[model samples]
Target: MIYNIYFDEANKIDQPGKANSYYGAYGGSEQTMTDITQTIQRMYEELGTKSELHFREYNHDQHLKKYFKVLHYIINQDVNINILIVNNTEAHSIAEQLNLTMMELRNLFYIKIPERLFYGVTRHLHGQLDVNIQIDRNDEYDALGLHSKIKEQMNAHSVYRSKRYKIASVVSEESHESIPLQIIDTFMGIVVFLMEQSYMADSNTTLIKSDLVYRFLSEGGNVERFIKQIKLYSWNGNENLSELSVGNYISQFMVYKARYDVSEIAKLQAIMLKNPGLLAKEYRNLMEYPNTLTRMLLGYKDEVEGRGRNYLLFQ
Candidate 1:
């Protein structure tokens, strides 16, 4: 089977700052991907889907129903959704500690996001699956020969050593013309807005955006399932990968998950081994709030791994 992946990013990852950055990939079989575009067109006629599908242009009063229809359809399809969230402050600090130029570190992430998105989607399949990627037009990636450079690296991934998947082509297209790009762009905006907690601010725009997000997740357990498909996480330089790799050092990514203090983790582990039943009943009874450094992981079903207790109160 052949796959066509559309890529988009939110936030400036290269620039040094405290804010979080995000990159997203969304696509699937060529037929499925095309069907999504056509499906939205039909919805446009029936439900009056907005002509401008970009999330930044969203108006709660006019676009909520239309956007929700698109969002609902996208989530239900058997497509791959992968997002990379990066902590900009941590990245710059890592660059300083490793004595690498800011440009050098930025170059690494520019490649890793697409590489991981490709891997995250195609890793499970074992066959000669032809993969093509189209990135939304952006300044950061708008350089001659960059597309070929990315294509070469993706085709060289170790996961594809068994001839599992081959990168066919990498191209850039305008988001306005590309339905796939616009779709991922909206999803990217949602993830970034939520992670930044901008919704907590008492602003008219924030309130509208919050309402849209809350409505998307209004159904029971819908949040967990929706979040899972996206695989939204980060590479914050927590662990070093400088010496482990052959070429330049790349920051290892840690997926989004809850985080408790060391003492709390140990205590929870003890409980798991002693009385597994009690662990469930009192797992929410955290002694102190979860560590604020990482803001904890979200949508955890259980504490079997002792990875954490409060998933940043995501529940």
Candidate 2:
């Protein structure tokens, strides 16, 4: 069977001190692309707007209602969805160990996360299945590099080498021109939003509730099942970094950034001891609120650090 995988990404990959999370989701099936495209086109016509459907633009009540309907329809399809969410702190620690620059780390993740997602999607298949991967084009890197990386990873895998699965091609296209890509984009937006909420809740940041998201979560079992299929991965340093306190990790990361004066790291370290989440948020307004860092430190103090493994198949 020839399966077409449409992929899209959300959130920044290499933000050093940002609280935002990263996600990539890809969905695949033989006929799902065509079916979703026609349904979305019909939705556009019915809504009396020629604009493309983007989840980020779902702000107004009318748009949210329409988007919820669209999501319901798409979630009911037979396509398989796989998602990857990165643990930024652990990823940063790994990048530091490897001496990778921000851009290099970004490129590595661009390849690694998606490759992991693809592997999870096809790991159980024991028959011939030709997979064609289509990613939304982004100028951060060229299509050739991504294509090469994906091919390399796929060929290196034992299952693929056994001839049960074949990578037909890895190509990039404009999201606006690909209906399947748009559907994946919408799905990723929902996933990213939920992740952000979880991050904020961990950080003790104020949570913003979305009725649309709640509706999807409550509508039926499929969306919840789809979410359970998401796989999260992170590169731990030589040791299990999650076992370390947020303060300890920050101090270590600061040592790596020794180019910055000692006073700055000291000041940040002191603040982290008191208010850890503040360290995760970008230095902007002087707002001091607990965030992920706080949770990490508390976890350390309770001797329950690393309670949750970073990479797991969502249950």
Report the number of the highest-lDDT candidate: 1
**Each candidate: RMSD:** 12.8, 14.6
TM-score of candidate 1 to 2 decimals: 0.70
lDDT of each: 0.64, 0.57
> Which window of ten consecutive residues has the lowest lDDT sum in model 2?
306-315
- Candidate 1 backbone clash number: 2
| Model 1: lowest-lDDT 10 consecutive positions | 246-255
The digit string of per-residue lDDT tens for model 1 on 76-110 reads 77777777777788887888999998777767778
- Compare the candidates by TM-score and give the number of the best one: 1
Candidate 1 runs further than 4 Å off:
14-18, 98-104, 158-160, 238-315
Question: Candidate 2 lDDT, tens digit per residue, 1-315?
Answer: 877777676767566565544445555566666777788788778767665567776544334446666777777776666655556776677778889986788887777767766776777666787788888887764833887788678857835457577788888899778877777777767656554443234222211124345444445674455544444433343332122122232233234323322343345455556665643344212223234233223222222223331111111
Pairs clashing within candidate 2: 203-291, 277-291
